[model samples]
Target: MRHRRGLVRLWDYAKPSWRRLTLALLCMGVEAVCVPLMIWTAKELLPPILQSGQSQALRRLDLVALAVLALGLLKGLASYGHYYLGNYVGQRVIQGLRGDLFWHLLRLSPRFFEETRSGKLISHLTNDVAVLQQVLSENIAQVLVTPLMALGTVVLMFLLSWRLTLLVLLGAPLLAWVLQQMGRKMRRVTERMQQRLADLTSLFQEVVLGIRIVQCFNAEERERQRFGAENERTFAAIMKGHQLQALMTPTIEWIGLTGMLLLLWFGGREVILAQRMGAEDLIALLGSVQVLITQMRKFGRLHLILQQGRAAGQRILEVLDLPPEIPQKPNAIALPDIQGHIQFDHVSFQYSSGEMVLHDISFEVRPGEVVAIAGPSGAGKTTLANLIPRLYDVTSGSVRVEGYDVRDWDLASLRSHIGIVPQEVLLFTGTVRENIAYGQPEASDEEVEWAARMAYAHEFIVRLPQGYQTWVGERGAKLSRGQCQRIAIARALLRNPRILILDEATSALDSESETLVQKALERLMEGRTTLIIAHRLSSIRHAHRILILDQGRIVEEGSHEELLGRGGLYSKLYELQSLQARGEGLE
Candidate 1:
């Protein structure tokens, strides 16, 4: 069920910037009081100025006007002050949330990324957060001030003439009814607006990120159609919201005008008959009526703003309420200096659907031992490697590093001891030196060069137009896959972690690049406990042990020669590859 959560929850973001919020409210309060106070002062002096019937009395009227103008000037200054403080608080809160979201994303399990679309998550972080910002800084600030202003105007009008005020008062319930219905409609529409906007943002993200794929697959027209449909839906939602609001302003104004006309006929008769009220009192009453009308119109619009803000606030609260899936336990012990002993003891896991990905797998690697895992596509080789880093806790067993369960160790210290090179080498747009030194940001120039040379990337980097200073371009699109892989290897080497996992580190490279990367890998794996996930038989030939995985279990385990000699699944795979290499057809 979609519950109606309000602005009280939205104020949680202001906790970090409470001082700014307080100052903004203070400014708003001062302005709210000033509006009616200025009106009351205008009403007070007008009687004396008109009845005196002298030039000096006209001077008093001029003075009263000047005082009213000064109050208005103060109100303008206060409005600016309110806006400045509100926006400052809003921006600070947004910055805090963004920082937390980025850190949390780094900690999420790899499966989290697989299930959640990147475009949708990006929409949450960017577009959704921005909508909440507009609500917090602009609309919410007005919500606080407008109600006080409207109530103040009503009270002043009542004091001026209770009789006419009663008639205006009669319309109050009707106005409230109008606002109530419109606010409810606006809230519903606002939620739809936010959802549609997120869809639009996701569409744009998908199109931009997969522009190459879209073009290659001749899906340009299809994507365009999809995006246009999304945009139309967004436009429709916005128009529906505005349509309700459009009715609001005109209806409130017409009601206020009807009250004003009633006041003119009734109050003018009181003045003409020389009743209890004077001409000046009638004027004051009319003036108060004018102030009431203006405030009521503003009040109606404020309802729409508040409803929109409330809807936005609810969306933001949902994100803030999502408990971290992997929170640090209280008093978690810091991991000791790792000697890279890793063990997976009867580890088992499944996806959210409970379809098992890894069975009761058990394995151990001593310090400085090299293990290679080969598998069919659906086997759990990658899952087993991931368990060591504590990316996902085992469903039934334990993964330990250096004798301590990874869950008991400080997550930061545990991750710091491990380095990983993924199958997809994602390079950011930065200098070659920067990319290589990413793993060890504070590494000196000599250390960077040493790591790059070990990875066989230094020679090619120096041969480029700007040497180490050359930009890699977006996702390293300017560099060959081999060059990007070499840089990734250099980054891992610079980290000099106690444990390293290379997932198909050289699979995409040509033979020449593979030879270079292999030499670099040899240097990198020298003293570290290394686990390699490989498809090519030659990559695992030198490993001390190789485990062949199929259907989430180890089907074969031995050295490459032993596996071949066994003549099982590994031998058949090897034979198929040997035949392909010799230009023989598959049977």
Candidate 2:
């Protein structure tokens, strides 16, 4: 029952395709029947014509030959049906699994990505899905249909002559024992091969992403050696898997050879001495022997294939069965159109370490208020801002929007109301217009232009040879860092979100670009709840209020002028920035 439950769990993920799988099985059944019919035709047709020299037997032979030919045609047609329908079912199952995996990964908390490598996650998405494809298309047919055909062959052999059938069946127990052990070894090697393949994929992605770093450090030789080592390990694993698979055929064939020799010696004595078997019966027994051998060979191959598929199926199942970290309640309420009155009430957050990143951090931003959070590098300013969008759940308190806790609102509704412009500028490979209007796909050309203008992106975008139609290349590589930031801002602007988050949005720009971006920021901040995490004192100088954070606590909070007068942490930071701006420090 436990094993049955495990298989049921695997198949449950291939939802709505049980009907297609049924059709594939029906086709396989037709093909299975054709095999025995063709064998029986050969057994019953030829002998009478050879011995009797009767005209009637010749006519019977011709009729049986035509029937075998027709069955052969039917088998060919069924084979095609099996391939097409099985492939269709496999593709559908993979599509559904990939879609679910992708959706789950995208919705997972940011910390998930922080701890996981991009390459490893990508391996799960691509290699793991391909493994499932192999299982569905190849292993499913073998597991379901091959064994039935083998069993039917054995039963038919017994009906023809129980003595010969018993001789053949004598080896089945020994064969089963050998195969069961081989299957265990195959499953182990298959899993190790999959793990090594994932490692290779992860290395490939990391190298590509950090190619510039590799070039800068002149570490090309180091990277090549690293990649070569992983590739060698992957190669060794695959060779081991193939070696295991290769053993199945010869080992099973040797067992069959021993059993066949035993049957031939004993059955020949029965026919020659006892006169108990007719020529027709001898022919039938020969055909049955050949058919039984064919079935055993297929069974051996099926066992190996099944083991391969089971290994991959188990891996795919691991990801599909990952319980969602933040699932919506059945009766979850849809959030109303937000007014952007954001409040973090006694909000405390800890990373997986249980060490606090934000400790009892409480703050509020009224609609149309521009609030700035300033601190040293590890002061949790960004973490506090992240809670507004529910990127991470507060450990012990509530982050509310318009009086409702974020956890109570549907995830999509809560996220749609907020737009975040991260410190790192990420843009897909696409035209400038598409990149700018990324957040709101249906935005009109005029709307896109308006957003670009507000972000001070239109001037440079028009300066490019292709203007808004130009490709950004991967990660907007063709554009400068400042250009990418402006494009990101344009995307957020087009969304027209109720709340805006700027995480050092101007940190990458030059003085000229920064000046333009600051103007754009002023326009963006108007009539919206804005949370700014800034290191540059000038960027948040006009903020309605500023909060200084230190060691996960709000050490100081006030207006820019008020904080300066009080001479707290904010005052010290401001003084340090002024000294640097004046070139009073060593330069």
Candidate 3:
């Protein structure tokens, strides 16, 4: 039942190209008829050669040769049309399907990305889809042509000798039963092989992304062993598939050959002793049966290709079937420019695993206020900031912006007015100007340079080989940490967001870079409602107020001086950091 549904979905993708497929089928029909006609002509030529005088026989031979040449030319033309049209339709369908898959993936929520492996998704887009393309372009022609060819040959055989045709028909059910059982096993084996390939892809991606860590720990050999083990498993699954395929072809051939030998014996005796049919008639009958057997063997091979395609199609559909986690309301309104007031009212949040990360969090930041949130690691500081942008919906209560719940606002409009600068900045492989202008693609070159100047990145950017056009390597590998952070700031500044989030933006930098980045960040926070999630106590000293959290709830809320005087968790944390800065050992 599942396979049936998959085939129906595949047909829907192919429906737009039905006109080309119909033409290909017509060519296949012409090709099928030509095979039987050629055999009948050969049978008729034999009697004249055996019974006529040399001159008459030579004349008959010349006419038959001309007839065979014309049929061959027609067959060749039809074959070309069938192949070219079939592949063209296949490429068009795959192009449409691949495009839709990518577009759907972009709309999925962050939670889906967190739970799914990036490598497996990549495999679906590339490897699995390629398998379906092979079936559509190559196997589809044989799938349609073989059955037509077989039917035409069978009709010609019955015309020559019905007795021999009936004997051949008796084995049809058994051959079909064998094919059915072998095909079921092949489908199961191919499905397992595809999964193994996906696992191999995921492991390879993991190693490449973490090559730095692997080299630091001297674990190259260990990673190699891991990859080798996965490769071995994939090999095993592939070998099992090959074994079934190998066993099936010969099994089909033996059944077909056995039926042919039986027919030859009966037909030979009738011509030699009973004189019921001539030798030329027997020869023609055998020739038609040979064509039928060849078509059946081709059908057996097509079955395997179809099963592999079904397995691949199933994987691609699985991704498309996932419902979007965060669906927007039908009447959601676009958020307009306003005072940046954000309020979290009795908010509690949890993940898909049911572990609550925030509990009864109630806070309100008035327009243009700078509120810093300080907490130990895993204290839900980042989680609280993520809620403002609607990256994750609140499980219980509501988060409102300027007197409107975020859920009531259009998703794109809501996010456009917000900017986040994370600790580890990610820059795409592009020029400095392009990265800065990412948020506003239509921004003028002058505007990009202006944003860069405001972020204090213009001076260093102009010194590079290509100036603003210098290519940053993957993830900004070519640039220093401070340079990447400054570029990120410029990107946010280009958007001119009303609200900003700084999640330990300068946490990983040296003192000099931190100072430069801090200055850029100060300029970014002016007149914007800002949430600062930080662990270094010194950074938040100038903030208007600080909110400290522990175990998913607010433990302290006060100004920097007030929190120091309280001698509570905040005081203890501050003292510990102060001691660490002085190069003192913790007991």
Candidate 4:
């Protein structure tokens, strides 16, 4: 039942390319026909043409030779058409699938990514997709051509000599057994190989992404060993499949040869002893036997390829089957121009595992209010702010923006009205202007410049070798952390969001960079409803209200000065920061 569904889904994807598939199939059919004709013509016509008197033989030979040449020409043209059009369809379908998969990724909630590894997702897009291409380009033709070739050859062999053909047919059961075993083994091996590939990819992604940490900790050798282990696993898995593929060809060859040896014995007896068969008849039967052997071998090989492709298709299906966790409510209205009166009303939340991370957290930021949430790590401060943007839905109760339950708003428009500058600023490998204007791609150059200036990112951008046009290497690795942070700010600034989220945005920068970012934040925050999650006590001093969270609950709430006077979680956090600063001579 499952297998049927998978094949049905695959056919749906192929249906759009039916015209190309039809053309390729036609070419495959032509090639299949040509192979047996060429062999049969050579076996029957060549000897007869020779036996004729020289003058008559010359005339027959010319026609026979031309006919054979024409078959070869047709075969070559059809083979070329089969391969080229097959690739066109395969590539086109793969392009569409990749696009759909990527868009699906965009639709998936953060929860999906939280559980799925980056490398595995990438493997789905690359190695997995490549296997499907093989299925389309090579396996499809093999499916049509191999069976037809085998059936045709068998029919031709029977016409030449049924008794010898029956001897060949005896090996069919063993040949079928071989293919079945190899397929089962190859299926398991291919799945393992793909998994190993994802592991290697994940390891490489992690090691490359955290190269600084690896180098700083002198863990290069450790990482190399880890990657080497994964590489060896992949190599072993591949060789296992290769061994099965290699074994299939020869085993089937030996089976077919057993049939040939029997034919050689019996057919020779008829020619020399019984005098019942002509040499032409024996030669043609032998030629058909060889053609049958070749096509049977092709069947074994194509079976393994198809099995490998089947494994890949299952992997792709796994992702395609996942429904977007944060699918919006049907008929949800667009969030009207947000007045930014954000409220979290007795909201509780948990991850997919249902372990509560936020417990009945309630808070309100009136329009233009700058509310700061201060908490220890893992205290759910970030999780609380993420709710307003509906990155994840509340487990109970409601989060409202502009007095409407967040679920009521259109997802796109809701997100459009809010901007978040997360702690770890991410920048694309593109120009400064491009990164700054990413949230508002249609923003003009002047607007981009204005936003960059507001974020204090303009100065560094201009000093770049190519100014706004400078290419920021992958994830802005070419720039300093402070520079990346500023660009993230500029990106959010350009959106001119109604509500702003500062998720420890300045927490990682040096004092100088933080000062510049904070100044930019102050200017950008004017009259905007803001939720600030800050670890540093100093950064949130100017916030209209401060909520101190601890272990998923708001333990204290007041302005920074009032919280300090209360001597609670907020004060304890402030004391820790002050002591650490004095110890480091920052005070």
For every model shown, the clashing-pair count is: 0, 0, 0, 0
lDDT of 2 by residue, 60-150 (tens): 8888888888989998998888878887877777787778788888777778777777665776787667866777776677666676666
Q: Candidate 1 residues 292-325, lDDT tens each? A: 6666656666676655555555655565555556
- 328 Cα displacement, candidate 1 (Å): 4.5
Pick by lDDT: which candidate is best? 3
Kindly report the root-mean-square deviation of model 2 from the true structure over all alpha carbons: 3.2
Task: Summarize candidate 3's per-residue lDDT along 233-278 as a digit string, tens digits.
Answer: 9999999999988997788778778878888899999898888888
What TM-scores do the predictions have? 0.89, 0.89, 0.92, 0.93
- Candidate lDDT scores, in order, read 0.80, 0.80, 0.88, 0.85
Query: Candidate 4 on 1-587: residue-level lDDT in tens?
Result: 44446678767777898998899989988998888888778775766565877787777778888889999999999999988888777777777777878899889999999998776687788878888888877677778888887887787778777877787687667777876777777778877877787677678778888999999999989888888888998999999879877986687668778777878889999889988778888988888878776777678778878877887888888898888888778888785576888888999999887789999888899999999998888999888888888989999989998888998988898999999999888788788888888889999999999999988989888998889999885744388888888888889989999999999988888988889999999988998999888999889999999988888999999988899999887888899998998887854
TM-score of 4: 0.93
| Greater-lDDT candidate between 1 and 4 | 4
Worst lDDT 10-window in candidate 3: 1-10
Backbone clash total for model 2 is: 0
What TM-score does candidate 2 get on C-alpha atoms? 0.89
User: Whose lDDT is higher: candidate 1's or candidate 3's?
Assistant: 3
State the weakest 10-residue window (summed lDDT) of model 4. Answer: 1-10
Runs in model 4 with CA error above 4 Å?
1-4, 49-53, 182-252, 475-477, 582-587
